[model samples]
Target: MKPALESSPGNPLAHLPFYYLDNFHRVLDWIGDRYADLLDGEEQAFLAGFPALPQPSRALFVRMVMRKGQLFRASKLQYDEIGCPRAAAAPLADAGWVVADPAVTLDELFDLLQKPEICRAFALPAGLKAARKDAQLEALRAAHDGARPFSGWFDGDAAYRIVAKPLCDRLRLIFFGNYHQDWTEFVLSDLGVYRFEKVEFADAARGFRTRRDIDEYLQLHACRERFGNGEHPADVLHDVPPPGTDNEWLKSRRDKLLFQLGQQFEKLRDWAGAHAVYRECGYPGARARAIRVLEKDERYGPAWELLQHALREPESEAERQHLLRMAPRLARHLGHPRTAAGRLAPPRRLDLALPQPDGDWWVEGVVRDHLCRDDAPVFYVENALINSLFGLLCWDAVFAAIPGAFFHPFHHGPADLHSADFHRRRADRFAACLAQLDDGSYVDTIRHNLVAKYGISSPFVYWNALDEDLLELALHCIPPAHLKHAFLRILQDVKANRAGFPDLIQFWPAERRYAMIEVKGPGDRLQDNQLRWIDYCARHDMPVTVCYLQWTQQ
Candidate 1:
C-alpha cells in the first residue's frame, strides 16, 4: 500500500515512487501549479493528462511538452504560427516566452543567455534552424576552396532566401565576390544599416578571389591599388576613387605621396636626397623651402652651400634678406667670427686678475688706471679679459642681491668664493634692500644705474649657480651671449695652442692638476666656452663642478 502524503512541502514529489505512474503524475501537477504562469495551454493539458497516462508514457510526454514550449519561445513566434493550437493560448502567446526572464534588466543575465548551454537549450524554429545551417555551410565553403558534392543543395530558392535576408554582412560576403558590382553598388548606395552590405561581402570573399575586377579597374585607371589581394571584398573599395573622373584626386594623392617620401628621407638623415626630391617637385619656392628643411635637420654644410649658390643668383631683396638671415646662422655653425689671433696681434702678456668686493675696484687697478690715463683706449684693448673677470666676480654679487640665495658651485675643489661665501652673505643684505624700497623706486634705481653705467636704458639682473653633480644642469642655464663668450675663449685658447687649454683657468684649482669648476649665482648660466671646457675636462678624467645659487628660507 502507498504511504500517506506528508504535510511538509519540502519537496512535494519526494515521497512519490521514483518510477511509478502515480508519482510522475503528482510531479507533473506540482510543476504546473508552481509555474502556472510559465506553462502554455498545451503544456498545461499535457500536465493535466499525467494522472491518466501510463507510467512509461508520462515521463516522455512531459519532456516533449516542455521541449515544444522552449522551441516555440526561442523562435520569436507563438505556437499558433508553428501550428500548435494548445500552446497558442500561453501567457507569452503574442511575443512568446523569453527562456530567461524577458523582463530581467541585468546585463549579466543577458550575457548568461549567450552561453553555449543556455543558447543550446533555447531552440529556434525549423526554418531559422535550416537557414543558420546554410550560413555555416556557406562560411565553410568560402573559407576552403573545396568542391563538395553537397554544395548544390544550397543553390536553389532556399539559398537565395537565406542569402537575401539582412543577415550578417560577413556571412553574406562569403556568398558574394568582393568586386561583385551589384553588391558593391548596393552597399555604397545605402545610407542606413545595409551600408555595410558590400563590406560584409568583401570581407567574406577576401583572399579567395584571385582576379578581382576592382583591382583591374584601379590598375587600368592609373589609380593606386588600395586593397591587398587577400583582403576582404568589402575593404576593396575602402581607398578607391569615387565613381567619376579620377585625375585630380589621383594627382593630389601622388603629390602627397611624393611629399611624404621626402619627409621620410629627411627622417632617415638623407637631407641631400630629400632636397633633391623637393627640387624635382618644381615648386616655385622650392629652393628656399628645401634650405629651411635642411637647416632644421642641421644639415648646415649642405644648407650653406645651397645658400651661397642662391646668393650668386640675381635674387630679389626678399630673397637676399632670407639668405642674409641664413648666413649668420651658417656662419655660427662654421665658427665664422674671426678670432683675435686671426685679426689682431697677440697680447704681450696674459693677466690673471682677482675679483674685488667693490664693483669699482679693478683687479689690477694701478695698471688699468695708468692705461686709462693714456691717450689709447685700454678698455677696448683689454675688453675680453675685463668681461671675463667681471662675469666671474659679479656672479656672486648679483646672486647675493636676490633674497634667500644659496650657491652650489660645481668644481673639483673648494667652492669658489664668488658663488659660495658671497651667495650666503649677500642674500640677506639684498633682501633687506628690496624690503626697504618700493617696487617703483627699485625699478627707477635699476633704470638709472643701467643708463649711467652700462649706457643701456633698461637694466634687469638674472643669476643662477651650478653644482658639480649638476654641471650639465648649470650649462643649460647660461645665457646664449655668455655661452658665446666662453666658447670664444676656448676657441681662442685652442687656436693659440692646438692641444687645448691646460685647464679652464676660472674653474681650475691652483693646487690640483685635474680639477675644474665653475660657479654661478642665482639666475646666472655657464658661458658656451665654459661648457666646452667642462666637456673637455670631463673627457680627460678631470673632476668638474658647476655650482648654482639657491635661495634658502631664513
Candidate 2:
C-alpha cells in the first residue's frame, strides 16, 4: 500500500521497503547520539550490540516491540518482506534480545489459542465445548492455572518473548519525552497524518537533566501501571517514589499519581487513607479532595481547618469554588458567625420552550438555532472560540524552545504545560504576548499566527471549530480588555480555566456588540466552573446570559 504523504519527494520513507525498521533505527541513533549520558550500562550494551545484529533480526525484533504484546507466535509472524519469521527470529533469540520460551499465565495461554486449539489441547467436555472463551478458561483454570512456558502447555511452534521490551520502552520514553507515543510517530509524520512544528535545540537541551530523573520516571510509571491494574491504593502508595526530586516535571507526575490514588481511596470509602494520600499530594485538586474526604467522614473540625488552608490560597478556581461551597455549613458546625460573601446578581435569564429538534441534535444546538437571527448570529462555541483565539495569540510563547519543553519533534505542546511553574518558566514570553492586547498590536499578531502556525497541534487550538469569518468577527467584537481578562484568567489555571466559557456567543456586527449565552436544558443546573465564569463575567461587566430550555413537546 502507498503511504499517504504531505510531500512525497521530501520523504525518505517513499523508497524504503522497510520503513518501520528505518524509523526504529532513527530513534536508536538519536538516543545514542543525544542521550548517551542518560544511558545506563544495560542500555549502552543494547545499543552497542544492536548494530552487530543481522538485518533480519533487527527488523523482526523491532516489529515485535512495536506490536501490542510482548509475545508473538512465530507461525503468525510471517512477513512477505522479511522472508522466514523463524529464521529472522533465531538471531534475535541467540542475541538474548528475545526469549524462545518465556513463561505465560493460564490467561495468556487462552489468549494465544483459538477455541479449536484449546479444545484439541485440553479435551474439554462436550457440555463445556460450546461455552464462551472466558468460560472455557474458567473450566480449565483449576487444573492449569499457574504460569508456564508455551512448550510446557501446547507443544506448538515457538513464541518469541521480547526480553528487551522494558529497556526499549525507556529508550522510547527518552526519545519521545514520555511513554505515550511510540515508533508510529515517525510513520505518521511520513504518512502526512500530522505535521509538527519543528523547534531547534542542541543535544544538551534534553528532557531529563540527571540519570535519577529517568529512573524515577520509570519507577513512577510502574507504580501507576500497578495501581491501574487493581492494586490497592495503600499498596500502590507504598511503591510510589517519594516526591523530593528537583525535577519539577517528574515531581508533577508523582503528585498527580498520588492525587489519583487518593481518589481511588475515596471511591473505596477508606476516608483516612484518602486523607493521608491527599495530605502529601501538592497536585492541583488534592487539598480540596482532602477537605471533602474529611467532611465525608464527619470529621468537621479538621475539614474546616483544611478548608481554611485551601481558601487562603486555592490552587485553582475549581478548588476555590469547592471551598466556598463547604464554608458556610462548616462555619455553622464550628459555632462561628456565618459570613456570606455578597453574591452578584445572576446573569439575565432566557426561558424558551422549543419542539424536539431533528436527528441527534443536542440541547445547546436547539437553543443556538432558536436564538440565532440574520443580524445577530450565535455560534455554539462552548470553550472553543476563546481558547482558539488565545492559542493563536500566544503561539510563540506556548511553543517556545525552552529546555525540557520541546526536546522531541512530535510534541503537541510543552511537556510541562500542567506543571506548577509552567507560567513562571515562560513568564516573559507570555507577558509579551498578552501585552500586545494592551497596545492594540494583538489583532495583527493573532492574524499573523492564524496563518503562519495553522494546522500545527496545540493544547488549546480547536482547528476544525475555527474559520476566517469566526476569527474576524471575534477580533472585532471582543473588547481588548475582555480578551486580556480571559487570557489572564487562563494563565491562572491553564488546566482548569480553559473550560467553562458560556456556551454560545452571538455577534452583532452592525452594532459592534456581542453577548455570551450559556444554555441549560430542562432540570440541568450550572456546573461550578460555569458558575465561576459567570461570576467573573459579572465582576468584569462582560455581557453574559443564561438560557434555560424546556421541551414544548416531550
Top lDDT prediction, candidate number: 2
Q: Which digits, one per residue and each the tens of the lDDT, describe model 2 over residues 393-427?
A: 99889988887788878998888898777788999
TM-score for each model: 0.20, 0.91
Q: lDDT of model 2 at residue 206?
A: 82
Q: Would you list the C-alpha lDDT of every candidate in the order shown?
A: 0.35, 0.86
RMSD in angstroms, all models? 30.2, 3.3
Worst 10 residues of 2 by lDDT: 1-10
Q: How many residue pairs clash in each candidate?
A: 36, 0
Worst 10 contiguous positions by lDDT, candidate 1: 155-164
Q: lDDT (0-100) at residue 86 of candidate 1?
A: 30
Residue-level lDDT for 375 in candidate 1: 24
Q: Write one digit per residue (lDDT tens) for candidate 1, span 1-554.
A: 11222222453444443323333344344444334444445555544543553333333322223222222222332222134323322322222222222222222222223333222333444443445443433433443453322213221111001111111122122222222322222212221212110111122112222223223333422322332233332343234433333322223333433444455566667776677656654222346657867887788888888888987972332344456667777778777873221111111123323233436643333333433322222221112332332233232233332221211111111112222133244445444434323332433443343333231111111112212222322222323334333333332332221222222222112221222234444465554334444554454444545534333444
